[model samples]
Target: MSETAPAASPSAVPLIRCRGLERAYGTASARTVALAGVDLDVVKGERIAMVGPSGSGKSTLLHLIGAMDAPDKGGVVVAGRDLARFDDAAAARFRREEIGFVFQFFNLVPTLSSLDNVALPARLAGKGASEAQAAAQKLLDRVGLGNRAADFPDALSGGQQQRVAVARALVNEPQIVLADEPTGALDRRTGEEILALLGEVVRERGATLLMATHSDAAVSIATRLLSVEDGRITEDRALTPITAPIKEHA
Candidate 1:
């Protein structure tokens, strides 16, 4: 959140920019402030871990970046598009075409097979059935779930379901991925596995990853750490580069 923070690279343009972002809940008299004057610049391909205590606006900021919620004050500019100017339909289109989302609970359709669940986003993005299936299959294979493509969410293990969720997020070939506590529901070892896969896929696609998490395992994959406190960024620092590749966890 500093103008003096070392730049991402020679490209001074940020893929995402949040200026004075503010969001709150409830009526003003009893309102809860979620974000207050947060300013951040995210360059392309940067992996950012947003860490904060509960109720500190970590999720609120992620929602704003992904167009899941509107900011009460200030604005967000993503890929040169001003989010405040987007209508409901436009926002939906943007999310479908440009941003991928991974959640803690997986959120796959209960009745859909793994392949179908993974292909859902691509279908919504207007890809044909065969194309969507192919993309979904590739992602599933990448996550080591290709053989389980026909299985439904309820039939899969927690780690497998999350792998499917990760595949679903990437099916559209989105440039940005927004994950909200993606491994919060998994055990420690499982969480580590999921994070490793998430990091690998994002890197493979050259996509930016913005995750809100409390887990140190989640933080390990990030190139930068952002600490949020009381609705504002309290710290932003670079992480040491990982010389060794993250081991395959599954």
Candidate 2:
């Protein structure tokens, strides 16, 4: 697979920024730290893959960046707006307009057709049904799922459902896409396909991508790799063209 170019110089304004971020769960007796003083900066158009063992703060960091969850300390700033400053309504608006998310479980509405599931985000943002459906159709085609648009989630294979999820993530033309273990549920071959599609579409749309995964094949496509452990980033480095070989599932 071809590698994406590096992002702009360090002087350029970062699209995502996290500063002294800290997150924890439970009470004092049973407290568990998810993130501890984690900081990061991502420029526009960067494909960043975060890899780590289970419960290593990868999901926590992604949540903070996506504003799905707030940090107990510090702040996350995306496109110049401090996430910590958003009120409930503003946060909702920001999520709808500025950020897109993909999850391990396809998370499609079981009752909605693939096209409708893709179009739902735009529709909820007050877009006309016709306009949203049109956009969703175009995305479905881009993901090679145009013919499956009318099928419900239960009717499609796992790979097909994931493709729909990807289309849904891009329907709103978000500036940032946060994926939490997006390929975790698939077999290796399907996972590679999903990762490749994500890299291609995200690059084509000029959207920054931050993906959390355990698969090295997934990391191979990233422009930068970050490894987190014990609630902190242990490695942050750029990947060369020959980062890692893509392996097939047995």
Candidate 3:
């Protein structure tokens, strides 16, 4: 028998691609297929909105794409790296370095000040305390929360806390921002403001944004609108170009 050379691993090209993604929970007899054969291609700097009714799999798709959860079958590729290739440790590092998340609940620690909360991610990534503080300060200022930096989560209003969460999401300067119902916690007025801020940040940083939302107003800023229903994508539409934020009406 002749000896053969080893095959090379897959190339690490930078883009988000999902192949026949399917996810289900619970036993086979009582399984819930949250996602079914979902295929997605998200390139750098693309603004995408995943819109669906409640329980329509929007959040599940976001979590899978963000590497927060894995599909029962199929693979998730981000920045040309297959997520399935990583071990638990590597996956955590990848998420820390490349994925930024904003949740609807604005999960800031109640005891921490806004500045400290925003700076926590960087700190966890081994940044020096002072460096994290400076970066957090700048981010909070960008989000118009500079004056509230010393305030704790309970002291700030819903919108302010969400703004702090936005700052925290950007603290690490991740390549992709995955947001799940980021505007859901706020009233219409405040939600519009946060959406506008998100639009501005996405444009300014040239970062890819994939948001899961049901609100029509949330989809207004998206460059592409994707509708998922019955565990499949039913529509993908490119809307009018979005350059400026739609003003919020009180």
Query: What TM-score do all the candidates reach, one by one?
Result: 0.96, 0.93, 0.92
Q: Write the per-residue lDDT of candidate 2 for residues 1-250, one digit (tens) a residue.
A: 3355344584789988899999999999999999988989899988999999999999999988887899999999999999988998999999999988999999999999999999999999999999999999999999989999899999999989999999999999999999999999999889988898888888889999999998888666788999999899998887753334333343
Model 2 is weakest, by summed lDDT over 10 consecutive residues, at 241-250
Q: lDDT by residue for model 3 over 23-46, one digit each (tens)?
A: 888898998889988987776777
- How much lDDT does candidate 1 score? 0.92
Q: Which candidate number has the best lDDT?
A: 1
> Which one wins by lDDT: 1 or 3?
1
User: What TM-score number comes out for model 1?
Assistant: 0.96
Index of the highest-TM-score prediction: 1
In terms of lDDT, model 2 sits at 0.90
Clashes of 1: 0
lDDT over C-alpha atoms for residue 29 of model 2: 100
Candidate 1 residues 1-250, lDDT tens each? 6777475775579999999999999996998999989999999989999899998999999999999999989999999999999999999999999999999999999999999999999998889999999999999999999999999999999999999999999998899999999989999889988888888889889999999998998778888999999999999988864645577643
- State residue 17's C-alpha deviation in candidate 1, in Å: 0.4
